[model samples]
Target chain A: MLYIDSISKGIVIDHIRAGAGFSIFKYLDLDKADFTVALIINAPSKKLGKKDLIKIENKIDLDLAMLGFIDPNITVNIIEGEKIVEKINLSLPRRVEGIIECKNPRCVTSMERNIVHKFVLMDEKDGVYKCEYCDQIYSWEG
Target chain B: MLQGKHLIDPEDFSIEELGSILELAEDMLNNQAKFKDVCNGQILGTLFYEPSTRTRFSFEAAMIRLGGRVIGFAEPGSSSVMKGESIPDTIRTVASYVDIIAMRHPKEGAPKYASYYSPIPIINAGDGGHQHPTQMLTDLFTIKEVKGKLSNLTIGLCGDLKFGRTVHSLIKAMSRYENVKFLLISPNELQIPEYIRTEILANKDIPFTEVERLEDVIDSLDILYMTRVQKERFFNEADYIRLKDSYILDKEKLKLAKDDLSILHPFPRVNEISYEIDEDPRACYFDQLKYGMYVRMALIAKLLGVA
Candidate 1:
């Protein structure tokens, strides 16, 4: 069990895979921010044997759409006055831009400078997205 | 409607559309020197999120041969992608400058997403192992050019059927024709994926049979489409060593095939096809590459509305 001192208001990202919490933290640039953020790794969870949580002190614009690519099972909860205000279940975006890299070596994006890699959601249930140019499928891992 | 359409799958094109493209391809093949300036003022934007030298070269050569300008990168490292730019923004920005777009990525449906955000037409060069429609067109054109007919033929697909996107796309495309049977040859581990067999073959009631040895059915094949079985695809070196030579096509195997049986390969071949067999009149892979270029020229011309 792990707990963080209460903050005025912010959000809590739960159910992150153990050891992956730091990746999410770095990906969202959590440490560089001025907000009081708590990252607890290897916490107890019934669903997952081990999990991680990130509690932020300040409420910022969080791109919930990206959580699906990071970890689909993650749950985001907004905290207001130390109370849960809103729970936003991160659903996979129909199209993911610049989140996941295209693994095809011959893609123009691989050679070009300053291009955004894009993928369209083909099967939401399967967490499958197709590359716009190549039609390759990428699945999100939980 | 095809002007801005997304080609995510080979079956996305109807028979009429395929015929139109094929007819255009034939014209391009017949009068190669006459159609050089068809796309002089146009631009083709290639957004490859994945690396494919064969496909990239095919599209680039096709556009350049048509007098169209080509732009874009072969990889993501040199681009704003290294700076974390979004795919939609990239697509929209590129679409603003180009007349048409061809993209290749490792994600399955990336092209479909780009199509949604793109103002120009999006051609899926390849998306992972999911789809490669142009290759299908190339295969179709090759079959038509060599075998002289797409229907009423026994096409033997040998080697890595499970992950061979070319075989899958070819089967899906050829299944639409009349009276075609498939001889699917592969090791147990490399058999055709069940989803393909259930959804494309059995569901459509197309006649197909699975076998381990190509020797059993080589004599009856009108077309033998061979794909490489990479050493990495096998679980162990022993299995790779055991089964590697099983699917190889040399002069010995050629003896079992018909005199007119056309041999096709998607190239960059390893030991799956012996070099000694290249001189045989039946070897049509090189001719297939030339036909591929012609068909792609036709496809580009037709899709660009110049043909």
Candidate 2:
């Protein structure tokens, strides 16, 4: 029953888990970007009982892996002339840098400065990721 | 194929590659004099960001016996690291002088991090309580040399399995072999990490059993790998005092073990193996200690492509 105007050429990030909309908003820097983005939260979803949706009114290059890391079920629909042109389906990212820190106090990343925290996807189904430097296991909530 | 490779984990090398290194180590053990000058012109950088006298000495000795020179600091205080030089930068600087580097740090994955920026070969001597591939290599060499095989045996990993990187690497490396079962013995507080339990053992369908007492399973083991169990892991003094004596491998416990059972330990011992167990024929820690050096020699030679 909620209505928002569709963008002619932009992206639609749909099916975000209900509570995860803010994180995706911050990850996209939508608040600071020079464009119009409408964040619709708690929208009724067919797959997810309730979901969050993001509508960007201008085309932007998104870090799909970051979005996938935030929520894998998110669908990124690219639109042109108000018609969907492309769809990018994302799974777990193979490697993520500067995100997903190694929480182990004894990890090398903890002992250094200016080192990019790196994690590699070890198991897709299990959402298992491993720190590249220390081998600490990290599980994605998604 | 091992040439210029960094051994960050035991799984870095395939079974055949590990087999090749161990076979070369065995050959070096037999014909020691032939390898005297194999690395005559090379130099090894021993970068011990934290103080580990035994592992540092082992690498230095290994390189020296191969007719190479050793250089580097034993502590961060002696190196530029104290001034906040990063691991990658420090490795890049040291790689200019040495053909290969053996590094040990208190931080897990320090060596792996160094390998990323290092132009030369990087050998992880020990990284926090993370992976220690060479110690695992030393263990595999000792077991294979003693038992004449790496498979069809039950390996009993006793004490501190949770934080013992050597046990983690050994279990992973040996899991690739055929029919190598594991008997993990640790107090409830010091059991193996769940990632290892689910990812490595259970995922591969390897047979394993977790137990608190060692005596109940001493006779079931073909090889007993002992590691120290610290009192701090226990919840209280009463628990530590109650369970402290359970893991000690004394003469009374050794008598219950199999006749040809090989007892191994990564040394710098602390009451894990009583002094009384030293005279036994199967006390392989001393020889295992020596094989630690031999394995390093083989590893360095292979990395430098000199042997």
Candidate 3:
């Protein structure tokens, strides 16, 4: 295991579902962020069996609700001055706008340019979202 | 309250709203002349991205019968969609010209998407095997007219359950009623999707059963909803060929049904129901066309706030 220094101040997104760390990275646009970021994939966990962890070394504002929609198992810990300040437990977002694209070809957003794909979280425990326009269900499961 | 409402799915209307539409339909059935000119000045814009004679003609006839005018393309080739115009732009442009829109696209949720940008009420004519709310409304109207009530009925949905949008919508719509048991009839290869079975039916505690042969439960069904197994829905032609003739409702099959069993099909059917059975008194499929027109008229008038 490679060791990395603990962040002095920033957000640590932990307990992501196994194999979902890359999606969270892309979903949060962490690739383009101007901050020190450490992505630990396939970390062993007693609860999840295997998981991904993301440590961001900056006080960044983010939609943790949307993150919960991506992976409900995810937990976020905000650290300030190398001490835990806030911890966000993940739960399904009631509604999400523009974070994900509607893949259904018949979805209006697919043909209409520049229209934000708005989704309403229908089943929170299942993390199922339904398109506001066409009622197409999108779950977090592939 | 249904006036100026966008109906994207069968559930978009509350049970009360559905009742209101059904009530209006009943009134129209009793006194057709009273609603003949209900929408005299209103205009309906029909935006069909795919080819559809039955749906397009139904909407146009309904609007015309209500003294409302319709202006739209029968297909995308004539519209700005051929020029690569986005659906939002087309809907935005059409909203400026019409009081309401009846849109049909090959995509599953096109109308729902358009509803976001449209200022006027948007009726989903059919969206890419996703929804056909008006058709479901018409079906309910037909069922009530024939059977005298929407509840306490066993409806058997046969053929292509996986790709049949009408079956899916009707199932969802009827699930709202009391004692609506479903006898899902189809080949194992063409069985209803699991989500519909588990989420829509089982989750709601609606009693249902799956069967491969229609003849097995024909005597028990109050309504026999037949659908064509479309060639387009299958990936492998061999699979389509094998399943295409699985359930042909011939005169012999009709012998198994009840005397008052109402048979319906959302048409352009290919070989699902034999022509010999069309003369049977129980075949209410043809009547569905007329009821479809009247129900659509009620829907349009209600959506436009005329009724």
Per-residue CA lDDT of model 2 for B1-307, tens digit only, reads: 9898888888899989999999889988999999999999899999987767668989999999999999999988988998989988899899998899998888888888888898889988888777789999999999998999999999999988877878888899988999999999998877888778887899899999999888999999999999976553344798667766667888989889999999999877889899998989989999999999899999999999988
**What DockQ does each candidate score versus the true complex, computed on alpha carbons?**
0.09, 0.78, 0.53
TM-scores of the models, in the given order?
A: 0.68, 0.95, 0.89
lDDT of 2 by residue, A58-101 (tens): 98889998888988888999999999999988778899889778
Q: Cα miss at A47, model 3 (Å)?
A: 5.1
Please report the candidate that would top TM-score against the real structure.
Answer: 2
What ordering of candidates by DockQ runs from best to worst? 2, 3, 1
CAPRI-wise, candidate 2 is medium
Quantify all predictions' global Cα lDDT against the true fold: 0.82, 0.88, 0.87
Total clashes for model 2: 0
For B21-108, candidate 3 gives per-residue lDDT tens digits of 9888878877889988889898999998887888899999989989989999988999789999888889999999999999988877
Clashing pairs in 3: A106-B107, A106-B108, A133-B112
Q: Which is better, 1 or 2, measured by TM-score? A: 2
Model 1 B-chain TM: 0.93
RMSD of each: 7.9, 2.1, 3.0
Off by over 4 Å in 3: A1-9, A16-55, A81-83, A95-122, A126-142
Q: Residue-wise lDDT of candidate 1 within A1-142, one digit each (tens)?
A: 4456876688899888788899899988998988688999999999999999898988788777787677777889889988999887777788788877777653545644566788887667777676564544566775
Question: Using lDDT as the measure, which candidate wins?
Answer: 2
